[model samples]
Target chain A: MNIDSIKNGYVIDHITAGQAMNIYHFLNLDAMDCPIAIIKNASSKRMGKKDIIKIDIETDINLDILGFIDKDLTINVIKNGERIKKYNPELPATVKNIIKCKNPRCITSTEQELDHIFKLTDKKNNVYRCLYCEAKAGK
Target chain B: MRHLIDITDLSVEELDELLDLASDIAENPKKYQESCKHKKLASLFFEPSTRTRLSFEAAMFDLGGNVLTVSDANSSSASKGESVADTAKTVSCYADIIAMRHPKEGAPFVASKNASIPVINAGDGGHNHPTQTLTDLLTIKREKGRLDNLTVGFCGDLKFGRTVHSLIDALSRYTNIKFVLISPEELKLPSYVKKDVLAANNLEYVQTADLEEVIPQLDILYMTRVQRERFFNEEDYLRLKDSYILTPEKLKKAKEDLAILHPLPRVNEISVAIDEDPRACYFKQVLNGKFVRMALILTLLKEAGTL
Candidate 1:
């Protein structure tokens, strides 16, 4: 597999195996008009099996979106044909439209215009509750 | 502008002010008879609520204010598919304040976001009824004479009872307040509430299925009905409906001065025989609801500069 290295882009690595597609869809990678490569079940020393995504364009990505999906994933920033920085995304204080409230009584269910918002109520348990109904976010 | 969407919207100081104002209203009704003269309140109830709707109307009437009511969703512009925001904007034109009740949670919040006037959440599905919490607080303060240093036992449907949740949130702010949550296993209080409100506040709480064992230790017994409307399955509702009946037998072991409170329209969770007991404060709670609501309307209107 001869995947070309990106000149100026992002290389999202260390994704748990079989989660690359979810990140791709959540990040709307397919909608972008740029060269992208998703390597699934890639061999790794630290992680037994990992998924990697390479974006050819230096586009800004929302780390919060990635962090909410899985905080353990590594985010690598590339510039001038070299790796510039690498870090992990922290749990966001709040998320909007990332996950919809499944509670039928929630306002977001009836009012389509309302944003599906969830706030991190429990940091230790990584629990998120709906802003309106306070129902725990579904896993 | 201020709105009463949640009990936590009011600080302990503000809550105390409301409580004090409510006490004053109870003591001297004539003093506040003309406080809201010429001011109008719009009652928009999209669901059937006999107590809350009447309480708001009675509160407005008590203040010598006229009321504009939309008692049913089918009779309102909502049936014509008007959005809550549009309705709120339209109502803001005719009223000094808006008290809205919707079957969907957070409808009043949306109204507050769009309305020019302050919006009070009368009752929103199984979510929040802030005024009810105020009623319960005033009842507790009047009965026990203090909000803190008391063992409060919440009996029956804790899961779907918004009053239970709101009252717990309100009481968690006071010091030395312990909770004895008595409910069936399937209808126990939600863990997020326990974690965020109880445990986070460093409040001691015990969860149990038996209410009788913990009855004697409680200073206040907050009874809640197993609401049929909140249950999707009839079987589940039927199974839990009679989980805890506060009969005369159950009260034998309870404290002599235990304040028994219920947010009413109760469906036999409390026996009618208990109505004659000295400790039964539910009816008094209903009357306190009107006074507290009057205080709330006055406070919001005053803060919004409508007064």
Candidate 2:
């Protein structure tokens, strides 16, 4: 109904509603005490219904995963009293240090001590491949 | 590498090396038992797999490796609302390696990407099963003494059979191999595979609706269950059920060296009477699965400098 602004925090606005939990888990924010507000089923003219998260601390947002849900979501960094930096997530080159791959048969899924890395292959298709299994997404 | 996601990632030489080592392990089990000692393996099977999980555990045990497992999806955090990726990252922290079997396509690939450790795809949902491919290759080699230049017959449901698809793709790399694709017209090989994998290579093959017509010609009679449910029409399934049954009478037409292979836990595709045949090699294929897995473990750990 109204545009509520943040004082000195970050807001991830315009996230797809159902994916809020997925986003939450991907970022591992359940245990943090940084005063995070997750607003789900919020009103949006473009999306009809939307979700947003506000964190009252300076943290690096992973736009790579955000790009997966809705590329249009906005990331605003709050400074002393005003929004300073803004992030318009570009589709990542390689999905590194970001979302874990979902293919259960990929080598990254098995090796307990290895980093699950993926190369974002097709920009238009949003396709990725596991570094171990070389299993491309959409397979 | 964190996972054995696909066999295609392995070059021919690398695959051969694994096969060679598997053979060596099969021959000399005592030498490899100490290879992964003090190391732990976790099999997080999200699907019900009796054979694959047992082979994996046995392989680890034979290698003097310990194992932790979550075999049933309902028993794990997956039964809650945890994302597959988060579960992978969490499990990656627990074990040295993970073998996952999921009903979803590309599930292990997801775990491999999230984990810093190796991921072995025990199997996935009708997409790819590289380990099974390895086992089939090893079986072909062990029984036939080679992977090249043979007439391989695919009986029963070729259309939706993932193992047939993988085996055809793998064995096609060999020289002078011909295919005798025996399935009913209703359940023929998928067209993309026919176009891309079979015809693209200029390999010799024949598609036949009749198994009896070509049973005598094959060197490897690879039988897959012609499930009644595979048919869109029940009448069609009944009409075809009697055709694909592998019997001693059928084996009478096969070569003396003709190896009868199946990716088993058989369910009436091959008649129980056929099990007593000397050419029945599917049970030994199960044992070969362990050896190949052991070879894979040693190679991956050796590469990681942990073995």
Candidate 3:
């Protein structure tokens, strides 16, 4: 509540509240042992409202998913109270995995333990394509 | 490609390439019979589908490949509460490629995420079937001589028919094609499909429940099984069934150049007497499917540098 800051960690800021949990699962923050603070529906003067996740430990996350799911995620990694590195992943040229294809008939949509792989066909539009059913993806 | 989940994946050019390859395979079956000799095709069918399952197996074997099929989800680890992703991952390790069918919406997409091999969707709930679209494309090419400028009338089960949905999406790409949708009131084409695929493309189409009213207007009559369950009352199905049947009497009204197609294993939706008609090409469509699938395996593998 006091703008609770982490001693040494990263903060994923400026995420939409609606897509916050999706971004959370995309980054797999809960699976990590790091001390984390996830603040959802935080009032923001710039964007009216936003979601933020602060990690209090030095942990590397799979940025591929974060970039695919929510390209707007702004990651500011702080170490010793100084910005060590920041990752604002650009739209990846191709999506390896993330955001499952919505077509149930897509081979990726099957119940078997196969990887749900999709190609990032249209980056600006966030359009993905299932190789099996060939359905356009992303809501 | 990582997944053959829907028709939108392949562009018109790509679809033609696959179809061309299929035609070549069909023309010269012995030349490519052992094409996928050592390759294994794993079929993970969570839902029961005899036609699609057998088609996929037959396609793979026709290419000299073996199959590892799991047709029953109840018998698989899915009954033990395993997710589709986990099952597809483990199956990817054992097979060169996989074909899956599920009862849930978007189930194959979940499986393809964990699978390493090429994932071919045999079918899925009521979503899409790209391969079937490929088969339809091939059939169209063989029968109509071209995909363009043909008037295709889909009669029956457009609301929940995966084939209808996929074929609509695929056909929307060609130039000067017309659609005549003939279905009972309870089973008209979904508005979303009309909005997204038909109207958006500025394609011309008309909707009518009276099959005979417009049977003569069709260049292609694609029939589908109109089940009693699709109706709220058995009486309505009985009333509608005979009206839509592609009997010899109905064929008289159709054009001489018209081709009658049915994605077979059809019930009473099509009369046996019509099979002798030169234009009744449903059986030819089945053979076209096998050829198209063979072409698909060749083209995909060729692109992957595996064939």
Candidate 4:
């Protein structure tokens, strides 16, 4: 399976295995007209197996969602078929509308228009809690 | 300048100050009687809450302030589809401070974001009841004489009891505080709370099915009602309803000085017979609720430059 490398685009690498679909959905990659390739269970030296997403366009990616989904993920900017910049996404201090609060009694549940915001309460444990209901964000 | 959306919103120093103010008010009510003489409190209760709503109103009235109340959403413009933000903005225009009780967890937060005044979360769903936690703190301090180095036992529905969770969160910050969680398997404290608040803080806690087993070891016994509303299946609620009823027989093993606290409106979790016991402090908790509210109001008003 030889997928042509993009001349100028972003390669989101080191996604946890089986999480490419989640990233795809979360980033709304399907809505984009640009060509995108999701390689699942790809061989990796650091990670036993990982997923990589390649977007064939210089789209403004939401690094917060990428970091929240997989903290170890690396984003590579490819220019003229060569990697120009390689950096890891930082976990955002606060995230909005990325994940819904599951607590039934949370105000976000009742008020549909409100953004589902979560705060990174415990950085060491990678724990996020809903800003409204104080419910821990589920994996 | 700030809102009391969660118990953590108030720092340890702030909490101590509030507790001190509450103690002062309890001892000498006349000194702070006119604290909010020309102020107004908007009681925007989007849900049905008898105790919390009344406590806020009573506190404001005691402070020589008038209260503008909307007891339920049906009675307010909310029935006509007014958003919480809009309601908060409108209420802030009429009142100096707002005490909002909404069935939604983050409703008070929304109100606080939109309002110009301080927003007190009277009770927001099962997420938080910071004022109740404040009352519990004051009660613990008044009863135990210290918040640290005490083994507190929380009995009954720990999972759905917002007060129990809030108190546990508050107590976890103090030194040498151990928790003896007594509840049935169905009503055990939520794993998130156990993990986030207890484990993360490295706080000592033990889960037990028998309240009797842990009674003698506790310096404080916080009782909670097994709310029928929280359960989806009535049969499960019925089975676990009487799991930890604190009768005199059960209290035999408890310490003589054990401060039995309950965020009241109790229903059989604590036997009426134990009410005569000197350890019973739920009624005192109710009065403390008012005092704490008064303290909170004064502090918030002062912070907002309204007083």
Candidate 5:
């Protein structure tokens, strides 16, 4: 398989196997007009198998959504066909409009214009609770 | 700028201060009778409420403050599609403080953010009702003469009982407090509350299905009604509503000094036979609700420069 390296883009690597699709959808990669490649179950030395996403455009990505999805995934900034920088996304204290509160009793459920917000309650367990009802965010 | 949205919003020191103020009011009512004179309280109830709304109005009345009430959503501008923020802002112009109760959880939180005057969450679905917790605290303090070094048993629908959660959060701040949570398996206290409020605070608590077995050790037994409004299925509500009926027989094993507390408008979870018992402090809890609310109104009004 010969996949062309991007000149100026991002390579989202070290994604847990079978999670590239989740990242792609959450990051709204499907809406992007640039060239993109999602390599699933790629061979890796550290991980048994990993998924990687290569994007061919310079655009701002929502790291909060990405980190909420999987914090272990590394974001590689590529410039002129060379990796310029790489870093891990940090878990946000709070995220807005990333996910809707599922609890029917939550205020956000009735008020259509209200922003759906969730706060990180348990960092170790990656638990996010709705800011309105305190209901645990569903997967 | 100050709002009473959750019980944890007030610290132990603030709670003690409020208790002291409430106690002072109870002892010397004449001294604080006109403290809130010329001030007004707006009671906005988006849902139907009897005790909380009336108590808040009664509290303001006791302080010589007038009250403006919007008893239900249908009778208010909310029926004409006004948002909570707008209603709060509009009410702020007419009153010194606002007490709100909405069926949707966190509605008062939104009101607090938008309202210029201080806001109090009377009740918001199965969420925090800080005033109720304050009332419970005063009751416990009066009955036991202290807040700490006690075994408290919370009985009945702990899952949907916002009062139980708020009281637990409030009491967790005190030292030497142990909790005995008595509820049916299906209606047990939420794990997040246990993990965040109990385990996070390093408080000790035991969960059990049997109330009689743990009665003798309790310094306080907080009984909660299985709320039909909280349940989506009528069958589930009916099945669990009668789960923990505190009869005279059930109280036989309870400690002589045990303080029985309930956030009332009861649906037979507590028998009428037990009302005459010396241990029953639920009625006193209702009266405390008014006094503590008086203290709360004074505190918020003073802080807001409205008093």
Candidate 6:
């Protein structure tokens, strides 16, 4: 487990154990040309066990996807091999084309071209519902 | 300043205000007759709904405003592949307010996003019918003389009936509102509604197939048509269609003051003999629908600073 530290890149840290693969697939990290390493089940003092993704090059990441998948995830910006910034992404007020609304009668289900959008209606309950049919999102 | 996309869009205070305005309009119709004198309403109904469309037109007419209508998609540019946003923008130029019904669940929402004028959703697919919810609230308040502390029995199609869902969501906010959801197993209320609206709010509700068991306990009995269009199989529709018809004998145990309401154009779910019963208030509900629409139109126009 001797993963090299990146000089200038992003380290998506503190992902819930076993969620690294989901985050990887959701962000399409496989298609990137940069070097990436996923360390799963790394021991942590706060989280107990976590997964971390280390990218070798600095690039733009879709924070919305990160927030939607795991709101508690922290992104560590590594510059000159030093952790420059560590911040957790905020849950988006609204997300478009991320998770498909599963309601059969939803317009998005029938209309292929329409964007699948969900709005965060209950922040305290952490509930996101389909904008069209009002069906709770993520089923 | 926003559209009435869902019943939830209006706060409880706003809902109470609308009901108050509706009651005032009901009491003195002549006073609000010229409220929208120089304004106009555009009814762009991409779906065929006689009651909702006509009610909106009647509301605007009673308010001394004119109406511009495109009753169906085939009669408008929509048949030629025009998008809802484009049509809404185009209609905004001709009307001060827009009331639209469409087969797509979010078509009215799209219109509200694009149009400069205020947009009211008449009925959007099986998604929402906010005005019908408003009508139900007005009826309950007018009949029972209060909005809270009532047992409501919602019968027939709870699954596909947008009116039932909307009314339930609206009533869940009031105090001591209990719901008796009566429907066949196949047409039971959706789980999300049961969880998000009822359980989330801690509102007391019970699901039952026996309407008779709950009829006697209800302060308001809201009947909805078990729509054949919602069923995948014609045989299934036929089997469940007559399962909960409100006959006089069934109403024998009902409270004398129970208000029977149906967002009309009802089929066989309600017997015509029940029409003579003093409890049958669906006709009065229809009239209240018009007055509520008038109140809504005035409220939206005033919010937009047009009235």
Candidate 6: regions farther than 4 A off: A1-3, A13-34, A37-52, A58-64, A71-74, A84-90, A99-116, A122-127, B228-241
Between candidates 2 and 5, the one scoring higher on lDDT is 5
lDDT of 5 at B140: 97
> What are the TM-scores, per candidate, against the unseen true structure?
0.93, 0.71, 0.71, 0.91, 0.91, 0.87
RMSD of each: 2.5, 9.0, 6.1, 2.7, 2.8, 3.5
B1-307 per-residue lDDT for model 3 (tens digits) = 4467667878889887787788788788999889999988888898898877888889889999988989898899989988877888899789888888887756676676678777776776666677778888888888887999889999998898878888988899999989999998889999978987999899999999988889888888888888788788888888888777778887778899888888877888888898888998888888888788777766666665666
Q: What's the distance in Å from true for residue A20, model 5?
A: 3.3
State residue B36's C-alpha deviation in candidate 4, in Å.
Answer: 0.6
lDDT of 6 by residue, B96-181 (tens): 99998988888888789889999999988877889999999999999999999999999998987878888998999999998999
Q: Model 1 in CAPRI terms: which quality?
A: medium
Worst 10 residues of 6 chain B by lDDT: B1-10
Please estimate how well model 5 matches the true structure, expressed as its whole-model Cα lDDT. Answer: 0.90
TM-score of 3: 0.71
Provide fnat values for all models in the order shown. 0.76, 0.10, 0.19, 0.90, 0.76, 0.62
TM-score of chain B of 5: 0.94
Please write out the lDDT profile of model 4 over residues A1-139, one tens digit for every residue: 8888898889999999999999898888899899999999999999999999999986566556777888889999888789999998878888888778898877777678888999998888788988877788996
The residue-level lDDT of candidate 2 at B206 comes to 97
Task: Report how far off residue A44 is in candidate 6 (Å).
Answer: 11
Inter-residue clash pairs, candidate 6: none
Error of 2 at B261 (Å): 0.5
Model 5 regions lying over 4 Å from their true place: A30-33, A41-49, A58-64, B226-243
Ranking by lDDT: 1, 5, 4, 6, 2, 3
Best by DockQ: 4
Q: What would the DockQ be for model 2?
A: 0.08
> What TM-score quantifies how close candidate 6 is to the native fold?
0.87
Candidate 1 ranges with C-alpha deviation above 4 Å: B226-243
The sequence of per-residue lDDT tens digits that candidate 1 reaches over residues A34-80 is 99999999999999999999998866766677877888999889998
Best by TM-score: 1
Q: Assess the local accuracy of residue B232 in candidate 6 as a C-alpha lDDT between 0 and 100.
A: 88
State in Å the error of residue B288, model 6. Answer: 1.0
Rank order (by TM-score, best first): 1, 5, 4, 6, 3, 2
Q: Which is superior by lDDT, 1 or 5?
A: 1
